[model samples]
Target: MTAPMISFEFFPPKTAEGLAKLRETRKQLALLNPKFFSVTFGAGGSTRDRTLETVLEIQSEGHEAAPHISGVSSSGEEIQGLLETYRNKGINRLVVLRGDLPSGEVSAGDFHYANELVSFIRQTTGDWFHIEVAAYPEFHPEARSPSADLMHFKNKIDAGANTAITQYFYNPDAYFRFMDQCQSAGINVPIVPGVMPIYNITQLARFSDVCGADIPRWLRLRLQDYGDDLASLRAFGLDVVTELCQKLLAGGAPGLHFYTLNQAGIISTIASHLNLQGD
Candidate 1:
């Protein structure tokens, strides 16, 4: 069987100690031969410099890097400069998003939506970069309605996204249904499943609440039952997430993109469970 093309998402490290730890984590995960290592961009470009440095470092280490970009607060010139930098460094992929407005900030900047940024990238870069946009199988929290969310997703593809990576989901049916809706809407690009390993129950709960990713009552209760038993929590979480990955692949999902949270053990464990760590 052909090996699956896997990728990992990481945020820019803020300190030298954090960067060192990330490098160590990257070294371990590199064994899986990931397609690319994507670094997250912060809201309002807060981590712009750190993101650039991290991506450049990844490239220096002989791995493909996809830097996230947001046009929500950047001008044409600013985005163009980023394009040039990525091109110079031979970075060919980008995870594009209309990032959240920082707290207490109002202006949506020069661009309002991800589709506009997709259009701008197409116009400026002219196919030089492979753009990846975000998709929400469970619907975006800010979307007015389900159909509206799907329409906006299709709009991003219509503008110029090469493919999409969905928000991490545990319910395989949700992804399948989302894909069916996309197909009906005439979107033919790959919609890779985003996988987030359940590492910290509290952190996961907070994130899921904000992003609208349901944790199912049963799973929530299970985690809550674990209480302070982190070892048991992690093992159970791994099994659950691994089972989710298996179902996604078996059901014909294109690929898996792990939101690694800069940790190697959990992702590596999940990878081993899927038999993806084998040569």
Candidate 2:
């Protein structure tokens, strides 16, 4: 079989030091020859400028870069300005999201759902950008039901999303099952599996809670057992995640999109384990 697509994600840093570190992180990950690097827009469009700067820098480095654009807390005018800015910069890809409202924020702005944003992009820019939308294999926390979540995802695709990148989950079965459902629903676009390299149990738990990604009972307990011994935890976590990636690839996943957390050590190790460099 041909090599599957590989990609990495990073959040824009708010400090000069953080920005310098991300530059190094990107440098190391670039050796992996990722199809593209994605820079996240913060909640409520908080990191709008930073995200744009990061993506443009990545593009200047001679690599493809995708910037996430959230519409939940933005006006139609604001979103249009962003689109035009990216287009002027020669950015041809975007990861569009409904995004999260900032703390204590009310209104859903002009676009309430991701589909609305996707529709807006198509109507405004035609096929200029390759749009990517988020997917939830374990069902979105706010979703009314499994069917409801599926319907929402389909709506995004129908609205002209070119592809999807799912929220990270440790369970391969969840991903395969989601793929089955999507196929049944006639959603054939490539839905790349999101992979989060485990580094800390506490941090993982916090993220899982918010995103509704399940940490399987066995894995959770095992991770917790490691306690403060980070070395053992990392080794075990590496083995487990690598195995999960192996299963997904062997089962026909189109690609792996890693939430690198701005660190390259673990992800680079995982890529080496998978021979992702075609060695």
Candidate 3:
């Protein structure tokens, strides 16, 4: 089998020091030859300008940069303006989603769902961008049901998404099953597995809880047992995540899209373990 491709996700940094660190991180990870580096938008489009700035920096550094465009607090006209700016900047890819709203914020100010956002981008841009949408292998936390959740995914495809990046998951079976379901539903698009390398036990647990990404009872219990032993925790987590990556790649995953959280150490180590270090 051919080697699986890789990509990475990063959030916009808030400080000059953070930007400097991200530049170093990008320099190191660039050696792995990721297909692109995606910069995430803030919930309710709070970091719209920051996301654009980061993507521009990545592009200026000669890397493919895809910006995440959220719909929660944006209008169709507003998104069109952003798309126009990206097109002018020669950006050709985007991650589109119905991002969340903060407490007391309007649920859907100008766009309520991702499908609407996808449709609007298509109508506005006319194939100028390769759109990437989100998928949930274990099902979205707020989804009504599995089948219903799938319909929501299908809606994005119908609205003109080019591919999908699943929410980060550890269970390879869930991913395979999701692929099977997508096949059965006649939704054929590259659905890359989003891989989140485990580093901080407490942080990981909190994120998983909020996103509804399951941590399986066994792994959960084991991580809890480590207490404050970060070295041992990271070691064990690395082994587990690397094994998971091996299984997914062997099973025909198109690629691995890592949620790097703007750091490089764990991701670099994982890539090395997967023999994806460099040419």
Global lDDT of each model? 0.92, 0.95, 0.92
- lDDT for 41 in candidate 2 is 91
- Reference-based lDDT, residue 190, model 1: 93
Top lDDT hit: 2
Off by over 4 Å in 1: 277-279
| Reference-based TM-score, model 2 | 0.98
Ranking by lDDT: 2, 1, 3
Badly placed stretches (over 4 Å) of model 3 are 277-279
TM-scores, all candidates, are 0.98, 0.98, 0.97
For 1-279, candidate 3 gives per-residue lDDT tens digits of: 565778999999999999999999999899998899999998888899999999999999998999999899787788889999999999999999889997687558788899999998888889989999999999999999999999999999999999999999889999999999999999999999999999877999899999999998899889889999999998999999999999998899888999998999988998998887321
**1 or 2, greater by lDDT:** 2
What C-alpha lDDT, on a 0 to 100 scale, does residue 196 get in candidate 3? Answer: 94
Clashes of 2: 0
Candidate 3, residue 165: Cα displacement in angstroms equals 0.3
Residue-wise C-alpha lDDT for candidate 1, range 1-279, written one tens digit per residue: 656679999999998999999999999999998999999999989999999999999999999999999987788789889899999889999999999888888988888999999999999889899999999999999999999999999999999999999998889999999999999999999999999999878999999999899898899999999999999999999999999999998999877999999999999988888888422
